[model samples]
Target: MVATAETGVRRAAGTVPRPLRGTGIGWLFVTPFVVVFAVFWAGPLLVGLGMSFTDMRSTDVRNPLGVELVGLRNYLRLFDDELMRRAAVNTLVFVVTTLPLTIGLGLAAAVALNSGIARLPAAFFRLGYYLPYVTSIIGIAVAWRFLLDPEAGPVNQLLAAVGVDGPSWLADETLALPVIIVMTAWRSFGFDMIILLAALQGIPKELYEAAEVDGAGRWARFRWVTVPMLRPALLFCTVYSSIGFTQFMEEPLVMTRGGPAGATTSASLAIYNQFGSGNFGYAGAAATVLFTVIAALAFLQFRLGRSR
Candidate 1:
C-alpha cells in the first residue's frame, strides 16, 4: 500500500520510473576504439612476444609452423654480443644527455614565452618554436647532415673563414653521437616548451604576486612557487621523453646510418639492423628487451614522482 501510494505520488508529480538497463549506450560509444586497439596494438604485441621465443627467420614466413621454438636462447645470445652491448651503451648515453637538455631548454623557453610577452608576439614565437616538433624528423636529420658537412656546408664555411678547419663530423665516432644528440635535442625541446608553456599559463598570477609581496626575489619566487606547482607537468615530460629516447632510431638511421664504427647505433636501430640482416628471432629478442627496459624506467619514474 505504501509503495502504491508512492507510485501514485510520483505520477502526480509528473515523474515516471523506468527499468535499469545495461550500459549498452556507453559500450556503443567505446566499441570502435576497443576494436582498433585489439587489432593493432594487442594483437601485434602478442605476436611479437611469441616470435621472440622461436628461431624464426624471414625465410620461414612461408612455413611459419616449421620454425623451431628456441625458448630463451635468443635472449641469452644478446648478452654475449659485443655490438648489442655497444648499442645499449649508446642508447643510454643518448637518453641521459638529450633528456636534460630538452627539459631545461624547454622550461626556459616556456618561462620566456609566458612572461610579459605581448599576445601577437607570443603566438608568433610559440609557432616558430613548435615548427621543428611537427616537422618530419627524417627531413630534420637530412638538413642537419647538410649543415654539419665538413666541406662546403655553411657551418663549416663559416668556421673556415674564422681560420678553423672543420673535421669530418659524422665520420668521426667521437663526434657523430654528439652531433646526433644536438640535432635530436633541438628538434624535440620545442615539444616540451609547448607543454610547459600551457602549464605556466594555467598557474595563478596571485601566487606570483604573493611571493613578490613576501620579498621573494625572482629566483626565490621561481624555485619556490613555480617549481612546486609545475611538478606534474615536469613528471609527464620526463616520462614521455624517456620513452621516446629509449626508442631512438631515426636520427642514427638517417644521419649516420649508425656508422663511424657503430657509435650511433641505438637499441632500436640495432633491432632494425638485425631484422634487415634476416635474424628475425634475434631482432625480436632485442626488441623484447628494449620494451622491458622502457617499461621498467617508466614505472620507476612514476614511483619516484608519486613518492614526492
Candidate 2:
C-alpha cells in the first residue's frame, strides 16, 4: 500500500517471472567467441583466398612490390603436376585404410564398455585406451620413428627374439604407410569409443530387453537394435575420422618425412611442402582441392542421413 512502483502482491506459490532483458545477456556472453572467430578464422580464410590469386611466398612480403595476379595459371600447374596426382592417390588410400579400422574398432570398444561385460573400472580402461590420443602426435611419431628404424628398432628386436626377423617398418615403402595407418587407428579410436559409449548409454535399456524377448540372438540383436540406434553416432564418428585421415600430415611428416621414395606424402604434406618450395600460388590451388574433397565427404554424410 506504501510502494511507489514495481510493487505488486508478492507471489506466495506461483512461477517466477522471466527476465525482461530477453537475450541481451546471452548475446553479450557469446560476443567474445563471435569476435575471435571473425578475426582469427574468417580473417585468415579471406586473406588466404586472396593470397591464392597472387605469388605470395615466404619471401614475398620482404619486397615492397605487390604480388602479381596470375589468374588460373597456378591452378592449371597443380593439375599438371604428376607428383601432386600421386600425392592425391596416396592420400585417398590412407583415408580409405584409416577410416574403417579406426571407426570399426571404436564401435566394438564402445559396445563392450557400454555392455554388462564391463566389470572392470570403466574409467581406467577408457583412460588407458585414450592415453595414446592425449599423447603428443609429434612426440609419438618421433618415438615410433625410432621404434621402426630399419636396422635397430625394438619392434624388429622383439621379432628377432622370437626367431622371426621382421622387415623394416619405416624404411620399407610397402610397410611405412600401413604402419602409420595402424598407428593412427590405435590413437584415434579411443576418442570415438568414449563418445559412442556415452551415446550408447543414452539409449533405453528396455528396447534391448524387448529385443531379447523377441527371440533375437546376440548378433541379430546387435544388428537390428544396437546398430540401428547407433547409426547417428556412427555416422558422426565416420565423417570425423574420414576428414582427419584425409588431411593427415603430421604422421607421415614426422615418421617417413614423405617416404623412402615419396610413397607416404599425403596431400596435406604436399601442400605444406609447396609453401616451403615457394609455390604459394600452387599450394592455395591444392588447398581448394582438399576443401572440395572434404565438402563432398560432408555432403555425402548428409545424404546418408537422409537416406537413413
TM-score of 2: 0.87
Worst 10 residues of 1 by lDDT: 1-10
Q: What lDDT, from 0 to 1, does candidate 2 have? A: 0.82
Q: Model 1 over residues 65-163: C-alpha lDDT tens digits? A: 989999999999999999999999999999999999999989999999988989999999888888888899788887888988888678999999999
What's the lDDT for residue 242 in model 2?
82
Task: After superposing candidate 1 on the true structure, give the runs of residues whose Cα lies further than 4 Å from its correct spot.
Answer: 1-21
Model 2 steric clash pairs: none
Highest-TM-score candidate: 1
What TM-score does structure 1 among the candidates reach?
A: 0.90
